[model samples]
Target: MTEITADRVGGDWLSAPRAQAVFAALADQGFAAYAVGGCVRNALLGAPVEDLDIATEARPEETVAAVEAAGLKAVPTGADHGTITVVSEGEGFEVTTFRADVETDGRHARVRFSKTLEEDARRRDFTINALYARPDGQVIAPLGAGQLEDLAARRVRFIGDAEARIREDYLRILRYFRFAAWYGDPEAGFDPEALAAIAAEGAGLTRLSKERVGAEMKKLLSAPDPAPALGAMAQSGALARVLPGAVSESLAPLIHLEGQAGSGPEPLRRLAALGVRADVDLRLSKAEQKHLARLWEAVDSGAGPAALGYRFGEALARDALLLRAAALGMPLDPEALSEATHGARQSFPVSARDLMPERQGAEIGAALAELEARWIASGFTLDRAALLANLRKK
Candidate 1:
């Protein structure tokens, strides 16, 4: 009975020619197709719809044949899992056959393709994500009793029993917090039942792959304000379960500092603010690991913002300053921020080449290091000639 206005669902992505073509192909083949999950949920919430996913009564092979018959390309991207990527006009849309979970073992699920939309909706994680919309913007009412209300209230609740849902996939424990951070209402607070279920299932988190946990953490940290959700995770014991010794207290201050500094969410920086060694629990890229290591190094070095900027560049310097300020519960220094910007643009005037001849081999590197320290200590005011004059004195 719930319906989204045509105007709301009529965004460019939904109405694009290619999208309509895919819908038409499924309709012509007499398979009931509806834009499902995040696409429908985000559209109704007036949030950005990143991907268009369609759930159909058509079997995977049938879905494939229908798209190809319509002169569109069908790639069996997840064919074994009842999904096919239907390509039209160079854009790909994930077209999946409706499924019902047959068996689940905390990490993976074996699903059976089902013809009923109700079955498909029931198997989804959250109530809000179970709503569906037709190509023409007619939204099929969610089968769950309070789902529509949950969506309107900005509440992210697991479908059916929370513990049952979590047991189906331990990763849902982290996903619960991630979704809460991104989509749930911070003021409303998280659902107590969900939090309790998560707490009871905390041990299941250890079974999830580090990469999956890392990806979820990155998304959670990238939210506009993740502090409230993170605090909830800590309370539910899920935070400690995933990241031992991680604390959420400093994150709020860091977020406030970021706002004052006009910096958007930086997941790695926020993760650093948590003050845990994530390199062990999370699978970070080499570049991310190095950047994280440098943030900690800069913090421990007791380096001024200017020095941090000079050594790590402006962006990192700002992160270090913000993290340091948050740790100390102090307001950011405006002058220090300006100095960071200034220092990032400064180039050291004392390279090894400048120390060559007078200083050779290992001595050249040693001399350059000494002079660069003096140059930076001088607030970078000493030019090449002024710095080289120190060598003459020595």
Candidate 2:
């Protein structure tokens, strides 16, 4: 088992002035405060921590007062839920008081403020995530004695009853698969109870808004080895119900292809690999949908550099080609990629203005475009004068 020391948890976020201030304020108010949840779990794993969350024993009102007194801006983002967003120097830290779930609807939880770390840990999802680190560098583990053991064991066991936890929030069903994809060990396989609970609550996922489901699903599919989770979803019949896509029979090669392509992380290509339609209103904006549509076209057309440059922008064309290579399970040929990128960057040999005497207006533009296409087809060998000559002949 991998043991996490206090030094392992020290990073930019934990050491930030704002975060220190919040800790100091809560300490001064006689409240126990600590960084908890994914932040702590990710810290131990050396993963990038995007958000810092602090759980305190102080009440919401007291927490706000202490934050304001510490010269920080506190917004009552979820006062009823004992949570607030505290801003310091333009960065936001989500501060939530220790709370226990009073009631749950398998989608939303009604939580009540608590004063003990144990109560707070009891309300969380997974054992690894429930571990906490105090400001004094002491780790507080309430879920079980061996939080690090469970994490290293590659287990996704719940803090308590898997069914009760899944009942608290159906999104946990998807989160289970997502977290597993990113962190679980493939050799260990999914826990049977966790899998069964996820399957049972999968249909409740339909109750979630498309925007929420879309976000989670996209993240899930973007993982380094999303195939396992996707395959599990397909086997459990979850993808067909929540997502508007076909769960492909073969996704392992596509996942491996994604790792090979190494392109920018646009979830659309991954989603498309799952046989999803980009233009569907899965809660994307008109502009976003249009861009996805263009991406789809560029990937599907199998167009060369010139064709892609005209259809999509030069950069997008390169991205489309890379994603296309991934989807097709073809190795990313460095020579081909380099040639395409260089070709996309090269300027056309001639423009319509150069054909002023022979061809005029839109026809001149059309002629020049055709000449450029020929020049590109000839591997950029045709000179400007030759392109103009070709245009004139046409």
Candidate 3:
């Protein structure tokens, strides 16, 4: 395989002084280094590249020394995994040594350092991602026969042995579906061997961490056609094995609806469609857990502005309606979404003091609650005088 050089990246991402420094430092040290992985693939697809990863035949120690010699800060982000975080100026890039997996436990791999480019490319997940470019704009593609052909065809083919690759890491099962949703050609159907591998190794998914699973699940659910991929997950029994009670045969429509409704990609909406409670030990952060709880409460209540407005603050209430709108595949009542938001912004028209000496303490609190309820009941149309009159009647 040929490596991507500085010229192929349109000289934009690699134009940064740090990027040049990294390449020059590695080259000066007699090590072959190239910007690899997603950045290379994105450049090919004309997409915006965010992170640039470098792969070298150099060992971790050598790579670190070379980077530091170039006046960059080198951090041992994952030294055992042959990775070093190189920081230049204000930008940080991850550089990893070329490796071949020697041992696999279906979740983690034990890899051996490799000096050959073929050894490195052969270990990747998909074909479209295997192309490497050189600094002078030369693409060294050794993806023989049907591989590059498959990529141009938009087909997601496992690198070598599908079952063997899947056994190395069951997480690839979900990644396959994600890639399909994001990049596959509708004409090129899902690979049978890949699907079979996922079904057979579905049980291994439970061994993975919830945090990893949650991140991948979020990406899968956020895809344009999450229904088909999610349906595949359920059909393969991967969903049941990983999420236990989260597999719902009826979740496809809800996922489809949420995709159409178009909100920020909050995975909880998809999680809810699976019929699983938010309390599952999914390893979500306290803030994430709390946010989901608020959205769930608002959806379950199905009440008018004041009720929803009082229970859930404005932002969360809107999120709930958006979630419902997505699940229902219908537009929310512009009025309802806006009204809840507007009501949440307003203060009580008449506080206890504004009601004068007639109402105070428990009586005052009771009157306020009743007036608020009436204001909500009257389609939130009750004015200040009407609210005061209702409070007086109490």
* lDDT digits (tens) for residues 1-394 of candidate 1: 2343443365877888999999999999999899988887888878899999999999999998898999999999999999999999999999999999999999999999999999999899988889888898777765854777787778999998999999999999888888888888898999988998998888999999999999999999999999999999999998888788899999999999999999999999999889864496699999989989987887788888888889888988888899999999999988889999998999987677676677789998778888888888999999999888867887
Can you write out model 3's per-residue Cα lDDT over 79-107, one digit (the tens) per residue? 99999988887788888898999999989
**1-394 in candidate 2: lDDT tens per residue?**
3444544476877887877888898788778889998888888787898888998888889989998888889999998999988888888888898998999887778888898899998888888789788775456677666677778776777777888888888778788888888888777888888888777777787788777777787788778777787788777777777765676544666566545656544566667667676644468778767777777788778678656765566666766666666566676666655666666667775766677776678887677668877887887788998877665664
At residue 384, give the lDDT of candidate 1.
93
Q: Write the candidate numbers in order of decreasing TM-score.
A: 1, 2, 3
Q: List runs of model 2 lying over 4 Å from the truth.
A: 1-8, 15-17, 69-71, 88-91, 248-251, 261-264, 305-314, 357-362
lDDT of each candidate versus the true structure: 0.88, 0.76, 0.73
Residue 12, candidate 1: alpha-carbon lDDT: 76
Q: Could you give the candidate ranking by lDDT, starting with the highest?
A: 1, 2, 3
Candidates in order, TM-scores: namely: 0.96, 0.88, 0.87
Q: Which candidate is the best by TM-score?
A: 1
